[model samples]
Target chain A: MKHLSKVALLVAGVALAACSQPHLDGSGTGTGSGLGEAGSASDPTSVAYFNETIGDRVLFEVDQSTLSEQGRLVVLAQANWLLANSDFTAVIEGHADEQGTREYNLALGARRAAAVQELLVSQGVASNRLKTVSYGKERPLEVCSQEACYAQNRRSVTVLTAGLSS
Target chain B: MKKLAASLLIGLCAFGAMAQLAKAQSGPLRIEITDGVIEPLPYAVPDLVAETPGSNQIAKDMARVIAADLNGTGLFREIPAKAHISTITHFGSPVQFADWKAINAQALITGGVSVSGNELEVKFRVFDVFAGQELGNGLRFKGTTDGWRRMAHKVADAVYSRITGEGGYFDSRVVFVSETGPKNDRKKRLAIMDYDGANLQYLTDSSSIVLAPRFSPTGDRVLYTSYETGFPQVYVLNVGSAQRRVLSNQSGTMSFAPRFSPDGKSVVMSVTEGGNTDLYKMAIGGGKRVRLTSTPSIETAPSFSPDGSQIVFESDRSGSPQLYIMSANGGEAKRISFGQGRYGTPVWSPRGDLIAFTKQNKGRFHIGVMRTDGSDERLLTASFLDEGPTWAPNGRVIMFTRETRGSDGVSALYSVDVSGRNLKRVEVTGGGSDPAWSPLQ
Candidate 1:
């Protein structure tokens, strides 16, 4: 039964992604390969495009969870992308820099993820379509200890998946 | 000096001796541990006499473990066997006091090992060389050959207790999160080992992330946070059986930082709902949930006092993370930390006299301890990142996580004496973090 549902989800994802997926070979054959690929950076609906072009993450200052103006602008764009891609749901993973205690960083990460969730809900995204989890300082995008890396490490990343809200 | 002798007698009695020896001629040889720097007392432990032939390797291995346990404490230094003028050929042989005194050996440990089929038996004694008498009674342990290390630890604990007039922690175990892979995507699983980093066993796989595994008071079970269900939840695992299950399953809420109460009947942890987090206590079997704190700020890392009457935790209600104390039952809490830097992960000492915490100040993280009322706070270590301090079973030492700086930084377990001395890395394969020391087994 579990296997059947997983196959159903993959087939449904290919069908949904095929609508806006750009043809790479221009052969006019919808092979449904775009869903499994790394998702092209030029395709507006691709995961890579959402991550790079539309800005899928927002950073926070050290020891602070309140969103900055620039962070708010980034989240605003993320909200619009989520609103346009109604067939997709997102899981916002919160992270922290290596400057705080493990448990405190987890709570701090939760605050950051919630701040982004609040912004997305206010911008007409369905609240039920979003979930959040905190990784604290365990997962860091940048491993350096300087401010440049720390600023990037303390972030909330919205990861998209092709499925209905749980 | 009279009171010291009495305490030594009591410690020896509590350690379960098989036979009591007469007191030394002058006074009992003891090392009074203090905050001042101490010169490691010299001691010698020759290889245990293998009563049965072909068991020589096991006997030597056990002696090496016991020697390592004593020397690792920094309070005792082992005298090399080559420096010894006399060797212990028999467990029942009378000691040569003049020979040991000539070599400046203050303490002497002698033992014998005998194996019968799968059964192993060990007998040992501690002697004060200059005093010309045995410090305590001789003890014997019987177990399987596979449990020789534990027998060695038991001997080391008894020897340490008799010489230092304090409880021993060598027989304890530590539950920790083992890590591997890169910082961006690390693989973590629950693993446990003897206090000396031997007999390693993995409790869970790296498919799910586990953190801060704490042993129950009896050391039969462990409580930790797991992200297996895509969110943080508390899990109780049976150490012997390796069977585990989620403790709480409240939807729309995330639970983490779980600690067992002194009685092991309940657990206190942080539950996050909406955007804020608060402290909550619930029975281990899942019944009525008691809300411990209701604040707008974050409250986490709650640890019960040894007496189970009070709790010490970290909260950010005062604009920064600091330590707080409150009743075991839900009520108001008094702030206990007023230092310049932020403090978190407050753990009540097993002795109930001190609380260990992780402090971040001036761009450096530290593992520190302070009195229960927040007086005489002392930082024991400073590094790029050092946190999650767990007290030894005797509360005289602390083990914590220390991660180095840079992109290739890895987390490892390090322990320090409570007196701010004897800082050394706990040898474990690969990387480790969030070590929680179990009670003496």
Candidate 2:
């Protein structure tokens, strides 16, 4: 009985170890160890792959689209990945903080996305491969009225879609 | 020097006297006229006249509601019916000017109601309660008993216009999203009502979420957002027929917050495709979408300048959400808002001199006005959350959504003047948001 119990414990340990390993995709940056890096791709159907490169989307100051240095670096890296994965297409969603008029924010969101689109195109990503839209204070990642949440809400998100390569 | 000073003082007094004379002549019904002062006329609404025994209650209620709507704006003050010494129920009846003047009432409103079969006939007259003369001819409105409240509002509008020398907003309506349930699963429906929150009508059932219903300039149609297709999209609804059609169907995308151009021929909205939210302009009839912004930053809330030659919107491209202006054809947008705080919901004033917007600063949201180019930003009201400003027909007042952080946390409707005066709560049966004021009728 003691020998059988020892074997069962060894088998369970191996199973747990295998489950804990972070799976990397073709980009090779997916092994983030669950920190600020890309999360493991366990669910093949999940759209969380877009969140891999940019841990969270780049948030903007109120009524602004100029990417911060960190945001620029993230976009640059995203552009590089898109260039390498030639079959990939992305929709960059521009968002505004919950301030200003709804109509004005829509236009401002478009400007922000256009700014990112221009940058990506300059980096050699095909213009047709990317699309943009603005939510204009409608869809907020955070619901609080505080500035911190508003800051997180003002963002341009790049959603990656599969099946382009196949 | 003495002669010059005397002349100046005399000249000032004469000018003041002339101003008073002009005010008196401006209307036969002069209420709340003060020397050297120009303001919204103060008026008094007496209980309406009832034709039949049963009609009495309805008439009184309708009059009270109308009075409340007018008084809520802080523009008109209703003299308590108790203070009214004499009630002039007929147009031909001689108004007791001395009695009204004694009570310091400026304008007087008296109405009579008669029920003929299924039709209700309302005869109303506005008097210069102080001047002892009728401002205009007695007006008659005939409708069904169900429209008694609307008739009362129509009477109020007539009084408002005759006294203020501006078109009346009382006859108009407001389209808003009514909220219920919890924050995460809040059920929203498209609702419209008379400006006073009467005549409550729900255009869309609470099957899916709706947001930001905007009225067309003519008040015949409405544009709003719906999540019926599992994604937020813009839809146009005919006010009279309750007919609705989708404005955009770019599959697997979200498009919302639609506003009509000045002529009401085109719609400018935010369309989210591929996770990027940008502004796009499309014809009201729905064809040929033109992309307004090609940036990766948020560009939403597109509003046309009064002339439709330019557009103003809020963008976060500059690291924060600020106001920007661009040509109507979409090129070379310039940032106009340089205030210390964040600005959104930039609405161009109908008069073309100012743009009204909601400003968030230091943890408080304020409804404010700025010049067309973003200069002269003035914060009107500050609270936990004051947003979604809709301009009064005259552009003198702004109605907006004010959400006070209650112990349970709820939001309501509130209106304030563009000058930061006369803040009043708009009473609705339920919580309201995204109020769109209609043009003057």
Candidate 3:
């Protein structure tokens, strides 16, 4: 009980500290500060801040890896975030909606992750700092079998790694 | 994988002479079997006589295993032993054909067991009840006590061979990914076990994700995909020593779904360079990799035919996944899947007659088989999630992965006969997927 209380106090202290940090750092005044990986501690410049506030995951259509207009805009915002924070490297994780064969979905996931990486590089995010991996249909954000859940499951997530603070 | 022919010299029984005489006079009372799933032939197996102390329990368990093997095939029905009116208390006892025939048993098997130190010896015979004679010469198998399951499998193989006139798959092993933990963050390890899900031995720990373990033609080496390097890569493992190495360490490249060629010296798999995933072939002994397909679209899940003349793989070049066939040397591809569903993971049966695959259509997944040309498609199973099919050595049955739905979704291994009868869940200790049946051992 004592250890639990200590952890609770530490979490509360961190929460208060996060609430005090300034959030106006991005080149364009967006909701997120466009932080690096270290900013996941609630700093505005952390990619974690970008993910939670501006969205780092983009959903795809059923069995299709082609990015929608909204998905394109999401990737563009991610590209701009990466451009503003060039010190942060990234790995895009591609996933499927669990409606297909394991092997095909794996390939589809690869295509999706690659699509995101390509778009980022095309927008001037250093290609050398980016890598791609397909989690395939093995990982899903939603569990329900309906289309609503599937739409959520079919996604490509850009995860920033190795921040400038390090 | 060698089939032991019933050599008449192994039998010490005097009935060997009588069996040859009966084969000539009565033309061997073999039951006629058709392709259709007919009523299984009823058989009776009495508890094996324990000729030595401490052999009593093993002898009974051996008899039960043999009975379970035959009865599980949907080809034989083992009558309850309690209904028996007569018992063979001695291994050399005379036949009680009338008692077995009265119980509607078309066949009867008698076995004797003796244990000495760490070794166990078993002797068994199959009798055609109506014919009033033994079908073939009696068989004997001796091994260490720990090999009791194999002894039982050998006995079942003998009985199944005599009855069905086809090779038995009882003595085979399967390499699969044993899954654990929850659905979203599941962990998988490479594992080898008996075809009946007995004697599981894990080859790798759950530290790294593993998938789609395929056995070589000789069953001594395994080709599988592992995420140990933080990406999906193919690795070959020596089953006995567990010594493993990555098949291809190409920088910035990812490979998976490795399958050995028919000759066992080469592996055909899928490798993704940059963003395009295509099929590639590499030598098992290590050499320059040969590219098999050059499509910009994803082409993967390549499997060799039994004779190594062709390969059946899945490609999405048409914008949707479909089955395709091409020469072993790689060239123009011919699409085989014309059904209304997306097809992937085309595995050629060991018998070289059919290709088993996973299909997705109208929100349901199926494990199906088709001819080499994609004709005569038969959906063997339909479920919310069924995929990753591997064929038994004899091509008589198929085992695949079946996952449940919902937040608590879990994957388990299941098998069904080629005739779609005898659909049963393999009793694995934990969650498992991607089962690859080894050739007979």
Report lDDT (CA) for all predictions. Answer: 0.84, 0.70, 0.81
Runs of candidate 2 with Cα error greater than 4 angstroms are A1-166, B1-25, B28-43, B51-54, B89-91, B405-407
DockQ of each: 0.17, 0.07, 0.14
On lDDT, the leading prediction is 1
Candidate with top TM-score is 1
lDDT of 1 by residue, B1-441 (tens): 011000111112222434445443334578877775577788899999999987798899999999999999988889999999998999888899999988888899999999887778888888888889877678778777877888898899988888777799998899999999977568999999999898788989999889999989998889999988878899999888788999976866788999999999999999887768899999999887799999889999999999999999999999999999999996989999988899999999999999999999998788889999999998888877889999999999999999877766789999989888878889999899999999987
| TM-score: model 2 vs. ground truth | 0.72
- Chain A TM-score of model 3 comes to 0.72
Clashing pairs in 3: A35-A45, A35-A46, A36-A45, A36-A46
Flag the better candidate by DockQ, 1 or 2. Answer: 1
Q: Is candidate 1 or candidate 3 better by lDDT?
A: 1
Ten residues in sequence with the least summed lDDT for candidate 2 chain B: B3-12
**How far out, in Å, is residue A25 in model 3?**
30
Residue lDDT tens for model 2, A1-166: 0011111111110011111211122232211112232235454323454475343267676656778888888888778777776766776777776555555566566667767787888999988787666655555555555565567667787766544621
User: Ten consecutive residues with minimal summed lDDT in candidate 3 chain B?
Assistant: B1-10
lDDT, candidate 1, A110-154, per-residue tens: 988888989999999998998877888877777666676787788
TM match of model 1 to true structure = 0.89
* Chain B only, TM-score of each candidate: 0.95, 0.86, 0.93
